[model samples]
Target: MANALLLALALLAQDSQTGGQAAAQGPNAPPTDEYGYVAWCYGALGGYANLYDRVMPEVTRIEKAFPGPDGVAASLKTYPELRAQAQKDLKTFASAITAAEKASPRPISEYGGAQVKRGAAIWQGADSVSKARLAQMWMSWSPPGDCEKRAKTLETKSTILGKALNFNSASATTQAPPPETPAPQPEAPAPQPAAEAAPPAPAPEPVATPKAEPAKTAPVKAAKAETKPAAKKLPPIGGNEVIVDPVNPIPCAGSLVPAKRGGRDVLICKGD
Candidate 1:
């Protein structure tokens, strides 16, 4: 990603230079092939240089660590094929870098466009080289542990490369100075309070009043007539009952006896 950004900055510088020249020269200058070539170079260098640096070391490392199957040399034996591919990719990248370096500054847009193309090429080349390295590693080893480790390493490198590529491309194409946001308007001032007025008049009193009612009279009671003392009642004879206007039975010695009977009354009776 850092490399990509550097490439983008280079492209931007070139663009600024070209744009300034064009503005100074006015619109009549005839377009030149030099401009196109310069553009191509800018793109190419931005895109492929990092890939070359990263892949070369990885290729060398893998070739050196090549494990043999059946005690026979694996990677070293296959070096010719790997080396040929690497050499071809390297040549392509060098050519692109040369072209970009020689490219003259043009309009910023044109320069950015060229850089974008170059970035894409770099990404492709890097991917190819990474894949080739992985293939070489796998071909040289059959051990699961070794393969897993290599795969993880490859994944990490690839992820980093991808991020760098994306950032570089974005930086190259992104416009400078985001749109300005309008400042917020100040709120209107609140209304001021008026001076205090005189106090309101007191409410009028109600004329209606609740009257107290006269005390309630107590109810008259009829007086009971005085009666002479009643004479003692005689006891009844049967069961030793006492003689009274109303007789009440009472228990005595486990037998019932009347309270009044035959003008003679008995308090207790014996059981049979």
Candidate 2:
């Protein structure tokens, strides 16, 4: 009887252990306890949507006021830094949402409360900065135009913000906004008359021939012949014939004889 009682006690302990294990593994189990994170995500998303909606309408109103569509759009594109910040904020909000969804729902209520607080802080900061920028834009207006149109844009933005913050009854108080000034119309330029075709350049004048001068002839004179004296004949002498010196002989093979003494003569020398 004591052994039987011990066996029954062991079976009861086994059943309790199995039941506890099944309860722990149930489908309704919570995944995580990150309530603060979930609230931050929802608030951030709401804030971003509010900002986007507000900014876009203001931008559109400004464009309409400016009249020149391209100029207004281009001017907005110049604020790349502002646009980048907005995008970053939006992405952060989206990521937070994703993280919260993957987490346990039990923590979401607490997270939402924390997110609301954070959202309110960010909204206040952003609103102040936006107002300052708007003030600068207003200050830039010249004498003929004060920022009445820009003021209307601000009023609209405020309305959007109020709605985003869960106050749907809020409305813009700015009066009936004045219509945009029409741009000055440029005067049409006067058309110039077609120039009368210039008279064809006068036909070139006929070239005149120059008169030729008569040729001049010089007088002719006949030249007279010059008188010459008769030359004396030289007498021939047999031994007086010139003989060339051997050391200074002529290049010919025959020996030279003087045709006349004390006068020029031909000389001949023998070849080796």
Candidate 3:
């Protein structure tokens, strides 16, 4: 049963892989070929990279374990610089995807454009807090390794490879937070004079009580072994002895007597 279940799971994973990104894209979406793949990657990856730059510094400051030679203060000083490095990496990635698109046989289709718009919108519409949470969540997310490799391969290729990338973009329309109104500050009150301290109360006199009596325990009765009714005795064999089963099989008052013929031992009815 376990083996069958494992085989089924393996087949399912294989099916999902062969189905590719197109399985996620609806009928109206463009083919998930090389060009289509890169288009979606460009939007999603670019937006994610931008989001990291915007939120990572704040996220690092909020974390308890931000590493530094000195402490949190030194870490805070260095962490923001990471955002700059992230921006540089983002630039490199964007340039690669842009180049890949230019070299491709065709420009992004209408459906592909919608996907790109949705992908980018996800990051654009999100607030700093949401982006920070997303950056944290991104740490555990691992898509198929082939995704990046295939996207990289698309660069310098003139032919379109696959179908348009599609996914649920319901979260893409995250609304921007409303402007926060400033709260009015209250006026400070006048200072009051300190009061005199009170004296401590006297301790109460001790009261004596009678001592408790010792408890007496009752004796436990011993259990007696149960006695059974005696088994019936057989008649004496050949007027002298009675046939009996093997070694002390039956409870008897007589002594055992061996026989000459091949048979069970007999017991003398009378005990001396």
Candidate 4:
């Protein structure tokens, strides 16, 4: 640990000397080039370290409420001392990039270099607004991929942010709700067969009629007799002959007569 501190101090001292040389060249001389930015990747890692320090307390509190299986609490036990070291790191990194920018021939505006500086400063500031701004700047631009690899290496060597930076292991413990099971669909009703039409009513039975009598042959001697059609006879009630009463029954044409029949008084007709 002492040796690491010595190395950090030495690097800071070298950065200060380089910054002094850049000061002779003037503040607004030029922006940083890709090479200069790449050289400054160490400073960005330092910025991330400071950020880790600031959030450690909240992270600890969260673990207390909802513990993680990654032993984050145990890892962060030396946070106080690590935080102090991180502060020094932040300053050293800031100076490192400032010197790089001064020596760079490219303009700062070309790569949005101001945002990175602001992010570093904001991380040191440790205010809500500063933190938000830093997050925005980090999202706005990225350094070259190689620089990211360097940062990752730094994190691996870091005793502060170490594996705590990896949220994957922690996320694996919390299970997501199973995908919602779809409700069973109702089976469709079977199609019904079409109804058949009723057959036509049976034809009315045919009526029967009496056969006509055969025509009689006319006699040769009856040639003088005039032929006449026989008159049709009408059926009587109950097939009995009908009788009509006389218009006057006060006296018969032959004589007046009275009679009793069937114990009832009646007028008798004596006329031929």
Candidate 5:
């Protein structure tokens, strides 16, 4: 099936089939350590871009060594050997990627090593299927198997690359600036103290009501001055005389009356 033509299809485009594709061409393969580094590049980062620059010319030269198949039956005769070399070429590519990463320290490219490794793992699984088919091809005559393993490798590779692209876009948001901070407000004024109050006055004693002292007549009081005891009022020098018992003195100051004096009646000025 499709696997029968894989080696031919997998070969890089070349000017002409000048050499066999199954071996190192004009130039030597990288040393094992450098070649093994591709496994790490496959694991930790994506394959190296410079790998094509280093190996494509050699790959092209190697493919030219194996001329045209002209037909599938004719091509199948050498494809198994070529397929084995294809596996080695994959390893060589992995090593080159790792070597490039070490020499140049390309962190960004190496970042996809995880994906490269995963794709390599799938490619390894496909190679296992290819190995089984290679054994069957030599054991007995049978049609070539379908490239199911390679199909799976392509599907997984697509998934990994899609995730890588999405990750790059999402990482861009982190580069933008953060939001601005707000300013503080001023405080309010403090309160003042209040004034003190005054104390009350003492109560006074109550006044008593005097008994009704009748209003005294000023003229009547003057008329009674003749009897007021300032100085004894003298009897008037002339007055009508009346005989009055001595015991009964004249009722008025001017009244003359007879009074028994020394056991005899005597006419006397009563209260003169």
Candidate 6:
């Protein structure tokens, strides 16, 4: 602890010397007192650290995990490359976290609503996971693969962690929502000339109403005619007026003669 304080004091002394020649700001920009900001940061970090330790100690376990001859390294790839990528991801995630912290508690507006919804969804998904699960991912699992995804997700939800770690008690200034961009409208179809609109097709010729055959004098007269038997002639008993038989059954319109052919019953038409 004494050594840590000594190191912090040395760093502060160096920062104080460097800040004496700090860069100038724009005419409208508010003047920043770097020493005041640094002092506040120091106090906030110290207070958060004490609170975090009390709630969950074992913080030094993370410090012991350095990739070297004496420390654990990834088995999936060359340790040097893995360690390098891990460092880059760590920095990238840290930047995303800082952005999140700066953008929290945004003002609600119709402008850029979709983006607001998207950010809200990402934060919601981040909030749904238990701290215990996150702790296991960070401290229990083997390194690489899913570790990158978990780290990126955690970075996206840094505001939640900041609050959980007791660093975000006072409300940050509400951020202005982004401006909305309108979707492009489709162009109207080119108008056709009056002649090109096309005239309605002519109505089909009225179907011919077939002349109704005067109510068919006979129901199926042609069929009956087709089935009628041919006339048979009896030996001419009496000219074309062949004698008529009262008992002979004939299928056609024929005269049946009792005078027979040589002596039997037969039928004959008027001409026969």
Clashes (backbone N, CA, C under 3 Å), per candidate, total 25, 5, 12, 3, 19, 0
After best superposition, candidate 3 residue 104: deviation in angstroms?
5.3
What lDDT tens digits, residue by residue, belong to model 4 across residues 88-163?
A: 5545444544443444345543353554553243233334334433333322222223444433343334323324
Report how far off residue 261 is in candidate 2 (Å): 99
Please identify model 1 stretches exceeding 4 Å from their true place: 1-32, 62-108, 115-119, 125-130, 133-272
Question: Candidate 6's residue-wise lDDT over 91-162, tens digit each?
Answer: 553454344444455432232233223212211222344444332222321221322354356455655655
Error of 4 at 128 (Å): 7.6
Q: Which rank order by lDDT, best down to worst?
A: 3, 4, 1, 2, 5, 6
Q: List ranges where model 3 is wrong by over 4 Å.
A: 1-31, 65-112, 128-135, 138-144, 159-272
As a whole number from 0 to 100, the lDDT of residue 29 in candidate 3 is 25
Q: Which segments of model 2 are wrong by more than 4 Å? A: 1-45, 53-71, 77-102, 124-272
lDDT of each: 0.43, 0.41, 0.48, 0.44, 0.38, 0.37
Q: Quote the positional error of residue 244 for candidate 5 in Å.
A: 99
Predicted structure 3: lDDT: 0.48
Give the range of the ten consecutive residues with the poorest summed lDDT in model 4. 22-31
- Taking the tens digit of each residue's C-alpha lDDT, what string does model 3 give over 193-219? 777777777777777777877787676
TM-score winner, 4 or 6: 4
Root-mean-square deviation (CA) per prediction: 19.9, 30.3, 39.5, 24.2, 25.3, 25.8
Best candidate, TM-score: 3
C-alpha TM-scores of all predictions: 0.20, 0.22, 0.33, 0.25, 0.20, 0.17
Output the worst ten-in-a-row residue range by lDDT, candidate 1. 141-150
Task: Name the runs in model 4 displaced over 4 angstroms.
Answer: 1-54, 68-73, 78-92, 98-113, 118-272
Find the 10 residues in a row with the least total lDDT in model 3: 159-168
Superposition-based RMSD of candidate 4 using all C-alpha atoms, in angstroms: 24.2
